[model samples]
Target: MKEVFLSTRDFPVDEKFGLVSQILRSAYSVPSNIAEGSGRSTNKEFARFLDIALGSAFELETQLILASDIGYLSENKLQEIQTLLQEIQKMIYSFKMNL
Candidate 1:
């Protein structure tokens, strides 16, 4: 979402091209992959794409932790975002598995 990109601009400048970039890209990839997969004709292909999206969600989760640990992001500031990402990951995984 464009809203996420707008909000993440508040992250430290040092992370602009590092953690910030990684986090945004990975977060965006999850939904994008899901959409692209839905556009496919086959259930198998859609499931595969959902799996990739799920993986990206996990990747973003790790990056979030790293950013907070390294002080590029505040623990409290990222807590809600981290929780949301985990929820999305669970939803994505459940959908993918049911496919």
Candidate 2:
């Protein structure tokens, strides 16, 4: 996988302490929690991590919407990030349901 966090580097510097940072933090949390949970041995514990990841995905979606509304991000950019967030949300949801 590419460095997902690195991909957010292009967000406008004006958003350095705003939507840009929030989106980055939220998106990274999803995968970060997944990896950390995977390190645990129990399925239940892993499910908990997946749940947190789902929340992060939702948070990212919200941040993206806000960024678009604030003109901090273009419609294309919002859609792209939203697509990725949706995919991650689906994956996390599936994992949680299965567990």
Candidate 3:
């Protein structure tokens, strides 16, 4: 997610409050939700948080695709983020299942 944030540094200033913001918020949400969820007293609560994180991941994925399509991101960079997103999704799913 830090990488994603950094990657957006070169984005046009016009997008500073648009696509870039969305990407950053979505990237940050995953961990923020996980952290918030961990403080919950119940697995059910944590699972719900994971669901929110997963949703953010999916949203981020869509934004990334848009970034790539609009030429803001390179195919290689996009693939890297996509692969990481997949890994994150799998890990979150596994954690939810374990709960």
Candidate 4:
């Protein structure tokens, strides 16, 4: 989340309400959903939240790709973010399956 914010700080002013906003929302959504899910009373409910988090992770990945395509992010930076996002997605999936 911090990384997303930091990276977007360099984006064009026009993107403050565009790609940057979308990217930040999606990036934060992943963790927020996960945290929300963890507090659910039932495993099923938790799994549902994890599902949402996973979806957000995928959404964030797409936004990152779009940013790269637009030259807002470098290949290296995108790769770094992608790697971390993938790990988070995998962890969420695994935890959900166990639930």
Candidate 5:
């Protein structure tokens, strides 16, 4: 998430309310959902939040691709973040399944 914010710092100022905003919101959503879920009363409830986090992860993935397509991110940086996001997605999925 910090990496994302750092990377986006170089984005066009005009995008502050556009791609940048969407990217930041979705990026924040992933862990925010997980943390929110952790406080739930039941595994079922937590799993649901995990599902939402997974969706946000996927959304973040797409937004990152779009950012790359627009040349806001370099291929190397995109790959680095994508790999990390995928791992997080898998971890979330596995944890949700176990629940």
Candidate 6:
């Protein structure tokens, strides 16, 4: 998520509050949901939170693709982020499955 913020630092001022904001929110949601879900009392509740996190990961993935298409991110960078997001989603899914 820090990478997302840093990458958006050079975005146009107009986009600062647009694509940049969307990317940040979605990226932040992934880990934030995980942490929140971990604090829940039941595995079922935690799994629900993981589901939300997965959704956020998918959202982030889409935004990153948009960012790349719009030239805000380089293809290589997008690939890197996509790889990480996939890994995170897979880990979250595995955990949720165990629950």
In candidate 2, stretches whose alpha carbon ends up further than 4 angstroms from where it belongs are: 1-12
C-alpha positional error of residue 1 in candidate 3 after TM-score superposition, expressed in Å: 1.3
lDDT by residue for model 3 (1-99), tens: 777988899788999999999999999999999999999999999999999999999999999999999999999999998999989999998999999
Which of the two, 2 or 6, has more lDDT?
6
lDDT value for model 5: 0.94
Q: Which ranges in model 5 have alpha carbons more than 4 Å from their true place?
A: none
**Residue 78 miss distance in model 3 (angstroms):** 0.1
Which candidate number would show the highest lDDT if scored against the true structure? Answer: 5
Worst window of 10 by summed lDDT in candidate 2: 1-10
Judging by lDDT, tell me the better candidate of 1 and 5.
5
Which run of 10 residues does model 4 get worst, by summed lDDT?
1-10
The order by descending lDDT is 5, 3, 4, 6, 1, 2
- Work out how many backbone clashes candidate 4 has: 0
- In order, the Cα lDDT scores of the candidates are 0.82, 0.77, 0.94, 0.90, 0.94, 0.89
1 against 4, candidate with superior lDDT:
4
Against the true structure, candidate 5 reaches a TM-score of 0.97
Error of 6 at 18 (Å): 0.8
- Summarize candidate 5's per-residue lDDT along 2-85 as a digit string, tens digits: 778899998999999999999999999999999999999999999999999999999999999999999999989999999998
lDDT of 4 at 13: 98
Pull out the clashing pairs in model 4: none
For candidate 6, report its TM-score.
Answer: 0.94
Query: What order do you get sorting by TM-score, best first?
Result: 3, 5, 4, 6, 1, 2
Q: lDDT score, residue 51, model 2?
A: 88
